[model samples]
Target: MAWELATSCTNQRVVGSSQIQNEAMQIGRKEIKLNTTSRAYVDPDRINELKTISSESFDLSKLIRLCEELNICFAGECYLSMVMLTRAILDHVPPIFGSSSFQQVANNYSGAKSFKEAMQNLENSSRKISDYYLHSQIRKSESLPNVTQIDFSNNVDFLLSEVIRLLKK
Candidate 1:
């Protein structure tokens, strides 16, 4: 794949190949390079599956939109946005599981043990993290969250899979 480098205010150049001698190329006083790879935290297929479900009882528009935004935030390295979106989803999906809250879903839903575990993790862990970020005041010494700190991808995928299963039934 050809990578484009923005050298200056007006001039741009394309590198012919992926192999470059240096990660960044110096053009005059500016260093220019391409960020080639992109990341997806949420599986696109899972979002597609949610879209394919045509249910009259449940309006999934908001849920699907949250999931889509979660994917975008993670890919763009917006860890706080991603965490908040995840918390929103956990708050939004309870009624679909015949419960009024995620905690109740985690405890009472007749899902597989693994599904229940995933729900509990999201309910306990992600919610706490989200709350910390959401409610904590600015302090003298504050540490920002990184990708590893906010990664709940597998748990979310498991939860989405269960949602797809339940909705299709």
Candidate 2:
């Protein structure tokens, strides 16, 4: 399918297997990770179930406990745990979405692309979700805060620019 081909052509792609191996050597990497054996990746249904729970009913304390366990047991791939936590935030506590800390977590998982661009896209997605939230609200007088202004202009861009600048050194 077109989607499959497009995804396969993402920036993460290496031109050839030998090139990948060469790059790995230069980067001092030992392995080329095709798929992670993380339990979260294997269990799609559990992820979906956790995503559907209401914020009022959702147990943040329990999720934090799980995060701690994952951090201990799967410390090398802490990014997966972050993805899980971000998913939960998208489903339940959407307002706390674009905090500087969240942007830092995103930076941790970002690939070869500009992290600022990634964060900007995330904010755009959040805006769409917030529009939906506004429509669903019973009180018309209450307005959804425009977090995008606080996001792309200041925090994420600054953090990502600093990260990139450091990498150049």
Q: Pick the candidate with the highest TM-score.
A: 1
Candidate 2 lDDT over residue span 1-169, tens digit each? 3223223323442222233223334544333222332222112333233334455423444443342332221222333333333334334332233234544544444444665466556545544554455456476585433322212222222332433233332
**Superposed Cα deviation of residue 146, candidate 2 (Å):** 24
Q: Quantify all predictions' global Cα lDDT against the true fold.
A: 0.69, 0.35
Per-candidate clash tally: 0, 0
In the range 48-83, model 1's lDDT, one tens digit per residue, is 788889888898878777776664454345678889
TM-score of each: 0.76, 0.22
Model 1 stretches astray by more than 4 angstroms: 1-38
* TM-score between model 1 and native: 0.76
TM-score of 2: 0.22
Candidate 1, residue 133: Cα displacement in angstroms equals: 0.4
Ten contiguous residues with the weakest lDDT in model 2:
147-156
